[model samples]
Target chain A: MNKIIFLLTAVIVAAIIFFVPPIKGLGELAKIIFFHVPTAWVAVVAFFSSAFFAAKFLRTKNFSFDELSARAAKLGFVFVLLSTVSGAIFSKLTWGAYWNWDPRQTTIFVLILIYGAYLTLRAAVTDEKVRAKVSAVYSLLSVLTVPFLVFVLPRMYFSLHPSPINSSGVEMDSEVVIVLIAAVIDATLIFVRLMRR
Target chain B: MKLFGSRCDCVLAIVRKDFLLNLRRRATFAAMMMFALTATASLSLSTGGALLDEKFLAAILWVVIFFAAGAGLAGTFDDEAQAGTLPTLKLYGDAQAILFGKMSVAFLSLVALSTFILPIFLILFDVGVEKIFLLLATVLLGLIGLAAAGTLTAALTTSAAVKGGLFPILLFPVTLPIFLPAIRLTEISFTPAQVDSSLLVVILAFDAILILASSILYDYL
Candidate 1:
């Protein structure tokens, strides 16, 4: 099943890159949205799952839940790093600077920082039970602040980010939206498969 | 009524005990003050008293306080951990009361640290306080946020194997959201501009949330 899903995702990605038309003004560089946005989305999903598992661990005192939570966090951290690098490359091409401290940029940076701290914290403790409890508490704290960071803080700043979706409307081209949605679904599937492993 | 009174007394006793311990050692307090002073002196010496933009001064002041607090506040629970009293407290003491007592100590020390640092910061940097009351309000909220978040982080670090080294790594990122609004508020406090009351609300919200979270989560820790 994993192999089949992986192959299917690869094919869909190839189709996205080759068949989908470039955005009118953004040109081929807009293809990045398919990869970047979905990765970020997956990272957010993974983090919340990690927190969910952590909450479960705290309540049940089960080591298996702790293991699942740690795995989810690790996956989330990797996806966040991928999204950041992809976003930076896209930023460099379009905005003339790799990192402009845009609201989106700052938000991602903080996310990465928090994720890194979570992993470091997990590694620092020697005892398994203690580590699980400590990291669970930290994960709960992270989830509490993350919504404010991602949703509210960015709205306060004037961003150069092409916010294709917002409360106002979805301004994205239909083809681009299709490809982006497909990528997001594929990425989420990949995340689920990895978590099972 | 009896339970409430005894719980309050327990908290007070822990706070008083920690206060006396703090008074006797005085190292962390002096270190926080000295660190803040040294940072101010270095900034003063570097710019040679040249006039600085208010925004820059505000950032500098927060940077100093943030780092000083980061350097010093992580040790709030260190002595207890070292003396192996943490387990005893865990076994015999109310987790909530111990947390509150430790948080109270941290808050008091942060207040004292800011009090000592602010005057020198103003004199050395030649900052004319355009809104003294606003400055005080912002600083007070910032310190509360710091103390609330810092005490929780200190508790966390106390349990880790690499105690001292891991404190800032865990504390800094968790506290960034608090500092971002705080630096902006501090910058505005230096200007005559109408304060963005929202920033104060944000810090207040974070302080309350952190304290509440710490209280709930302290049980597991």
Candidate 2:
């Protein structure tokens, strides 16, 4: 199972880098999405995973569920950091400034602040159960605003960031689409595999 | 249906109880109101009578409100936490009622502070209220988001050993989106121009989702 997962991720990733056409305007910079989008999508999915287990933990008062939530949030934070940096690179290419206060940029900053606080809250508590309880609550509550922070709030402004995925997602060529779909599924399987462990 | 009505009663009861307690002590209100005034006054002094542009004016007004919220809103659950009534209070209808009750008090208290501070802000800063009704609507909607997010954050942080400093740190970022539209609206309010109100819709929707989510998550805390 593990070998198949690794092989699948490897094949899809290689295809993304070598096969997809360099985007117009974005040029090679768009290649980062193969890296950037999956990390972010996983990060978001991981946070939701965290929140799901958090709700479960709260309902059952089970420590294991809390443990899963904490790991997922922590993993999400790493991808969040990577995506923000990659986004800054993209911004530098397109927006002139690496850190323009664009709506999407601001939303990324907000996400950092949020999970940063979540991690800090987790670390601050000495009691395991208390740590789990508080972190779980934060995770669940934070997810509620994630949609607003990422979607609604950004749209209220005229954003410089390319909103390739609006109510309608990007109209990509089939090859790029196939690669992306595979990458997302494979990345999530890593989490599925980890959870099983 | 009956059970839901009973839950509403419980929420109202908690709201009333908090209001009465807050009225008697007025500690948080005084603290926050004073903070708002001095923050406003201090900003005036710092600028040294230089004329602020419309953006700075809108921004600073909310800086006052945000810091003022920081001053007292963290205590939303502090009274119960400190009094050791938290465990006992959880025996009520649910965390939803308790959260609403706590949220209402915090919302009203901040609104009251805004009521007092807005006039003082106008006089001290020498800015006029261009769109009073629109401004009030913006402020009211902004407060709902601020208060709900604030109350939920307060509950999250009140458990920590290092809560005092962490409150604003957590609260600020979470409420960033809420702050954005209000500043934009305040800017529009200055000119009373016919700009889009899609921002207000975003903030209101966020507030509704936040309160509902907080109520759902409040159970764990």
Candidate 3:
């Protein structure tokens, strides 16, 4: 059942990505945005979910919550990596540099570092009880830190980077919005299907 | 209110005890200062005795302090774990006190290292401090942020099998809001022109939020 759902989602998403005309400003680079933007959203949502489970584990002292937290963070880290690499490729096409230290890029780099630290941290501990508690603490701290790094600090500076999705009021064509919405749903559903294990 | 007062006393007592303990051992203290000096010396030599700008000097200064703090702060909790005093401290049910105590000591050691590093940097790099007061304020706030974040993380990793190797990797990312703006504030301190107060505001805000978060989260560790 899951495989069939995944296959249908994949085929339709791929078709929309290829057939859709490029946006006015982005040209061919627009194709990457379909993947990049949705991947970043999944990563952010996954991290928040991880933190939620971490908080739940801390409160209940239940092993299952810890498992959920660890799994979600791992998946989130993978999505973050995908988003960053895709974003870099898109940046190279448009900004003439693969890494410009744009405000968004800086935030993404911090996100990568935070989760890279998280994975290494998980490996560094062996005691099951200590591992659960410490990683839970770290997961919460890292997630709390995301807002300052990704949103607050970036906006403090005058940035040439794309204005935040909602704030700049960049009008999207109806078709483009539909594809983005579909991509988000597709990415999230994939996350849920795998995380169930 | 009375409970809060006694907790503050406990925190101060821990701070005092830690200071005395560090004074007695002196190993951590000496290592931190020496490491900072050696790192600064290498930078001076690599620059080939040429003059450096305030920007370059600011970057090098924080690098020295960051590494020195990294070297020193791990010992804060690890020493307790080694002596088996950590469980006793836990028995007392005053984790906040312990955290504040560690934070105070971290801040002190970092400041001690900074005092030594600054004079060496000034002489070696030949960059004047355009506003000594501003430099002092900026470094102080940066140290508070570093000490808070470092103490919490070091405590979390205290029970890990590889605390030494894990400490820096875990602590560095969480402390970026400290170092990034700190480097900016330090750069502003070196410039003789009109200073950008915005960076200071940013650092202050980050430091405030970071310290508050660290305190709230310290109990979990």
Candidate 4:
């Protein structure tokens, strides 16, 4: 039953992604948003869940919760990596550069660093209990700052990246929005399934 | 024995002990100053004494301070950990107090290091700041953010085998929010009307959140 649901969502998402008409003004490039935004969304969700489980571990001192947190973080890192790559490609196609130090670009770079450090810290520790405790604290710390990095810091500067929904009164096409939402829901469902496994 | 009664006293005592230890050793601060001096010299020589953009100069100054702090701040808890005194402190001292004390000492060391280096930096780079007050506030806030972030990171890295190396890796990424706004503020200090005053609040918020979270998580460390 679970495998069926996963497969069903996966196929449906693929269909929505490819079949959706090209967004106005962006053409084929608009498809990048489907892949990029949803991956980034999943990454954010994964990191939050990682922190949630880390807090649970801290409170309960349960090793399983630490394991879960670690799993979630690992997933988050992969998703963030995917998001970054897709965003870069999107930038290269639309903005004419693979890596412009745009505010959004810089923040994503920092997010990569934060989680990269988390993984390295995990690898450096030998004692099980110590590793769990330290990494849990580190994840919590990362989550504490992630908001400031992702949301607040970007706003501190002018950005050239296109945001899906923003305060500037720009509206995404309804068709594109549907595909993007479907993509996000699909990525999140996969994440949930992967976590359970 | 009595020093641990009140939180303020506990924090002060730890800061005092750390300061005394720092004075006797005198290595961390000296190393940091030496680093800043060498980096500034390299910058001047590399530029061939040419006048540079004030904003670029501002960025370079913060980079120097960031690296200098990285060079020194990792040892905030190193001495106690090496001497096997950490367990005692952990057992008897309030964890939050230890965190505050460690962060305070780190902030002070950074301030002293900056004071020694800032004049040299200004002289070597031939840059003028029209907003000394703004620069001062930015530097002070940057130092607090560094100390708060570094203290917690230092505590975490104490048990690692390769401590110094892992310190910067853990420290730099987590402190990005602090660094981004700090460098921008420093740039604005160089040219007052270039940016808004809102980033000042961001730095303050970063310090507050990190300190609060560190205080809560210190017990685990």
Which of the numbered candidates is closest to the native, going by highest DockQ? 1
lDDT of 3 by residue, B34-107 (tens): 88888888988898888777777888898888888888887688778888898698666488778887788888
lDDT of candidates 1 onward, in order = 0.84, 0.82, 0.82, 0.85
Stretches of model 1 off by over 4 angstroms after superposition = none
Q: Name the lDDT value of residue B45 in candidate 2.
A: 86
lDDT of 3 at B103: 85
lDDT per residue for candidate 2 within B1-221, as digits (tens), equals: 99889988988999898988888998778999899988999998888878888888999988889889888887788888889997777787577788888898889888898999998888887887788887899889988988998998888887788886788877877677778888988888888578667888878887888787777677657
Model 1 TM-score is: 0.95
RMSD of each: 1.7, 3.4, 2.1, 2.4
**Winning model by TM-score:** 1
Please provide, for model 1 over B91-119, each residue's C-alpha lDDT reduced to its tens digit, 9 standing for 90 to 100. 65688888888888888888888899999
**Given the true complex, what DockQ would model 3 score?**
0.65
Question: What lDDT does candidate 1 reach at residue B91?
Answer: 61
User: How accurate locally is residue A129 in candidate 3, as Cα lDDT from 0 to 100?
Assistant: 88
Q: Candidate 3: where is the Cα deviation over 4 Å?
A: A1-8, A156-158, A164-168, B51-53
lDDT per residue as tens, model 4, A42-88: 98888889899999999999999999999998999999999999999
Lowest summed lDDT window (length 10), candidate 1 chain B: B168-177
- Weakest 10 consecutive residues, lDDT, candidate 3 chain A? A155-164
lDDT of 1 at A74: 96
Report how closely model 4 matches the true complex, as a DockQ value. Answer: 0.65
The candidate 2 chain B region of ten consecutive residues with least summed lDDT is: B212-221
The residue-by-residue lDDT of candidate 4 on B65-174, one tens digit each, is 99899889988888888899877996766788888988999999999989999989988888778789888899999899889989999888777777778888898887
